[model samples]
Each structure stands twice: as structure tokens, then as C-alpha cells.
Target chain A: AQSVTQLDSQVPVFEEAPVELRCNYSSSVSVYLFWYVQYPNQGLQLLLKYLSGSTLVKGINGFEAEFNKSQTSFHLRKPSVHISDTAEYFCAVSVLHNQGGKLIFGQGTELSVKP
Target chain B: GAGVSQSPRYKVAKRGQDVALRCDPISGHVSLFWYQQALGQGPEFLTYFQNEAQLDKSGLPSDRFFAERPEGSVSTLKIQRTQQEDSAVYLCASSLAQGRTEAFFGQGTRLTVV
Candidate 1:
């Protein structure tokens, strides 16, 4: 079983300011990490995923995340944020495919970018 | 040609009413999933389907919750005796079943139990 923890429930940032959303996870076996973003009245969109090889993963929309094995963390970061970036974000984890792997998700963080 | 699609994007059901949410996954996608998201919370896994077989349903909260993917292309989630607690966004996702592949999500059905 795998679980994800999102440290913050809400984050407020001024437009063009850098922002970071913290996520931590617990799992006994090798796992996959992901970040998804949801705008108002929309479904989740994949931001990025950490599969293997690289610890620093770049995603769409200029967002990126780093997988720190020592910390068991995958923190999402963006150097500059836009008002359009205001949305809810979730961190998810799943055990590498052995059987039918199901994704476990975090509580989600609502990002508010103000102009 | 498309992504995951869900129908009846909004549903209003009275207490004790039965409701069914539908999902049409991307063609050729072999894995489908259902999740429930309360306001301000992340999606909680409800069930998973690998083709026509329901591979896992341990996350379903109650007996009233039921899901099926008989043909493997489309799936439905049925809620019986709808309660206020069931008032939430029911999301559907699809994947290729490959290792670490991203899951595509639908707009979700907003179920409001009045």
C-alpha cells in the first residue's frame, strides 16, 4: 500500500512569485510519483511524473518536481506563477506494476495566485 | 482522437434516489478507474478495472456503491439510496496499464444529493 501527504492545504502567492507545494509519501516497495493540477470546474491534468533515472523531472506549464529518495518527498516548484495557475493540485503514488496497481492520492492543495 | 469522457456532468438526486455515472475511456486504453472527490479534497479511489474485469474494489466505501465495465471500453458507477455524504464529484480515469503511465481523467460527474 502507498500513501501521499500534502503538507499544505492552501498556498497563496503573488503573480510572478515562485511557489512550491510539498508532498511526501510512504511505501515499502518501489513507487511512482505524480503531480496533477485541476482548474475550476475541470478534471485533473498530469503535471509530471517521476518514474526512474532522473530525480529532477520537468513537466508542462513550466512546472517541475524533484524526487528525493532520502526524504521520501516529491516537491512541486515553479519559478514564476501566473493567475491562471490558481488551481487545486494533488500528489499521487502507486506501486510499480506487479498486479493491478491503484493510485493513492494526497489531500490536495489549493493554489491561489493573485495579481 | 479523444480523452476520457463522462456523461451527465451534473446530477441532482433526491435522498434515496438511485444514480448512475458513466465514463467513456479512450479507445484502446485497457485500464479504467473510478474515484470520489469531496469538495476541497483529492480523489479517493473507488474501483479499478483491467479490461472487462474489475481488478480491485477495496476502496468502495459501502455496499451501495457499485461499478461495472462489462465491455472494457465504457464503465458506470451506480450509487443506491443516495445520501448527502454521497454528494461529491465522481471522477473517471483511464490508463494504458504500462508502468508509470499517466492516467487521463474526465470532467467528472458532480452528484448532488438533495
Candidate 2:
């Protein structure tokens, strides 16, 4: 079985400040990592994914994440954030060849950007 | 539709009643999935279907929960004798051909059992 753990349940930051959301996974097999953002009453939107190749993957809205194989971590980061970026973020993991690509998600971290 | 679509954005059913949630995946998508998201928690996998065949259903909480995708394009999750524990957002997602492809999500149907 695979699982994801997010270190923070909530993260508060000021506008234009940098932010990082930590995620760790436990999987015996190679896995694909992803970051998703969900606004209140809305579906989840893909932020970024780390499938293969580069360890550093960049995603939409100037967000990025690094897949550290050694630590089994894929943490999301943004150099600067805006008020519009406030939302609930989830870290997910999927086994490389799992049928239907079922995603195991973390508890989620709520990001609140203040002015 | 441009993306995955779920109907009845909100549903309220009395305890012991039955409810069915619908999901419309992207056209031509070969894989579909269902997940449950409780308050303040992440979505948990419930079931998976490839084409019209249900490949996995191990995540279903109990036998009372059932899902089906007859033609593969649209799917439905039926909860029999609904309970308060079944009150959560049911999300549907689909991918082009499965594997490592990105799965687009629907807005989800929020089911509340009173």
C-alpha cells in the first residue's frame, strides 16, 4: 500500500512571500508524484507532476516541486505567492503502472495568503 | 464536455434512504475513477473502471456502495441505505488511456445524509 503525508495542516504567509508545502510518501515501488490545488467548492486543479526525468518539475502559476528519491519527498514551493493563490493544496502519489492510476493523497494543507 | 462533469452538485438524503451520484467523464477517455472526500480531508480512492469493465473496487467502504459505467463514458455511484458517514464529496476523474497520464477531475457531488 502507498500513502502520502503532508507536514503542515495549514500555512500562513504574506503576499509576495515565499512558501513551501512539504510532502512525504511511503511506497516500495517507483511512483509518480503530483500537486493539486482546490478552491472552495471547486474541483481539484493540477499544479504540477513529476513523472520521469528531471527531479525539478515546474508547474502552473509559477509553482514548482522537487522529487527527492532519497528522502521520498516531493515538496511544493513558490518564490512568491499572491492572495489569489490561497487554497487547499494536496500531495498525491501513484504507482508507476497501477491500473486506472489510483491516487493516494495527503491530508492536504490549507494555504492562506494575507495582505 | 471540455472537462469531467458531475451532476447534482449537491444532494441531501435522509438516513436509510438511497442516493445515486453521476459522473460524466471527458469524451473518449478510457479510464475513470471515483473518490470520496470527507470534511477537512483529502480524497480517497473508491473505485476504478477501464472502458466498461470495473477493474478495481477494493477501496469501497462496504457492500452497500456500488458503481457502474455501462458504456464507459458516464458512470454512477450508488449508495444504499445512506448513513451520516457517507456524507461527503464524491469526485470523479478520467484519463486518456490510464498509466501515468493526468486525470482530470470533476467539480464533485456533495452528498449529505441527514
Candidate 3:
């Protein structure tokens, strides 16, 4: 079984400030990593995913994350944030073609971009 | 539909009442998934379907929870004898294929059991 861990439960940043949300995963085999954002009362929207290729994956809303294999991490980063960026972000993992495409999600990190 | 759609955006049920939530996946989607999200927590997988066949259901918390995707397009999750613990948002997602693909999500059905 695969699992995801988000190191931070909440992240607060001022408008136009840079922010990073840490995520780590534990799995015996290869996996697919993803970042999803959820606004209040809304469903999750895919921010980005790491299937394969470049370690640095760019996502919507100027967010990006680098996949670190040795560290087992896929941390999401945004160089500059806006007040509208405030939302809950989730880090998820799916086993590589072996686990039937089910996603295991982290506890989530709530990002608050203050004005 | 252009995207996944779930019915009854919000539902309030008395304890012990049975409730059913519906999900309509995007057209031509091959894989559909169900998840449950509690307050302040990430969404947890509940079940999965490949077309009309239910292949994975290990994530369903209890026997009280049942999900089916008939005709390979629309799905329904039925909860029997709901309890306060069952209050949560139910999310449905559909993917283009069976593996390593992005899944589109629905707005979710929020269920409140009292």
C-alpha cells in the first residue's frame, strides 16, 4: 500500500509572498504524484502531477513542485501568492499501474494567503 | 456532461436514515472513483469502478457503505442507517483510462447526518 504525508497542516503567507507546502510519500514501488487544490465548499482541482520526466513540474496558478526521488518528496511551491490563492492543498500518490489507479491522499495543508 | 456531476449538492439526513448519492462521470471516461472527505481532512478513497465493473472496494469503511456503477456511466453510493460519523462530503472522479492518468472531480455532495 502507498501513503502520502503532508509535513505541514497549515501555511500562512502575506500577499505577493513566496510559499512552499511540504509533502512526502512512502512506498515500496514507483508511484505517480499529484497536487490538488480545493477552495471552500468546492471539489479538488488538479494543480499538477508527476508521472515521469522532469523533476520540476509546473502547475496552474503559478504553482510548481519538484519531485525528489531520494528524499521521497514532492513539495509544492509558488513564487508569489495572492489572497485568492488561499485554499486547502492535498498531496496524493497512486501506485504505478499495479494498484488499479486508486489515489492515496495526505492529511492536507491549508494555505492562507493573507492580504 | 462536460465534467463530472454529482446530485443533491447538500443533503441533511436524520440518524438511521438511508441515503443515496449520485455521480455522473464525464462521457467516455473509463475509470470512476468515490471518496469521502471529513472536515479538515483530505479525501479518502471509498471505491473504484472500471466501466460497469467494481474492481476495488477495499476502501469502503463498512458494510453500510455500498457503491455501484451501472451501465458504466453513472454511479451511486448508498449509505444504510446513517450515523453522525457519516456526515462528510462525498466526491466522485473519473479518469480517461485505467492507469496513471488525471481524474476529473465533481463538486461533491455534502451530507449532514444528525
Best by the TM-score measure: 2
lDDT of 2 by residue, A56-114 (tens): 99999999999999999999999999999999999999874654589999999999999
List model 1 lDDT by residue over A5-34, tens digit each.
Answer: 999999999999999999999998989899
lDDT score of residue B9 within candidate 2: 99
Candidate 1 Cα outliers beyond 4 Å, as residue runs: none
Backbone collisions counted per model: 0, 0, 0
Cα deviation in Å at residue A67, candidate 1?
Answer: 0.2
RMSD of 3: 0.8
Give the alpha carbon lDDT tens digit for every residue of B27-91 in model 3.
99999999999988999999999999998999899999999988999999999999999999999
What TM value does model 1 have? 0.97
Q: Interface RMSD computed for candidate 1 is what?
A: 1.5
Better of 2 and 3 by DockQ: 2
Give the lDDT of residue A115 in candidate 2. 100
| Model 2 steric clash pairs | none
Query: Distance (Å) between predicted and true CA of B2, model 1?
Result: 0.5
Tell me the whole-model lDDT of each prediction, alpha carbons only: 0.92, 0.95, 0.94
Off by over 4 Å in 3: none
Q: Deviation in angstroms for B64 in model 1? A: 0.8
lDDT of 3 by residue, A1-115 (tens): 7889999998989999999999999999998999999999999899999999999999998999999999999999999999999999999999846457888999999999898
Per-residue lDDT over B1-114 for candidate 2, one digit per residue giving the tens place of the 0 to 100 score? 699999899999999999999999999999999999999999999999999999999999999999999987899999999999999999999999876899999999999999
Give per-model TM-scores.
0.97, 0.99, 0.98
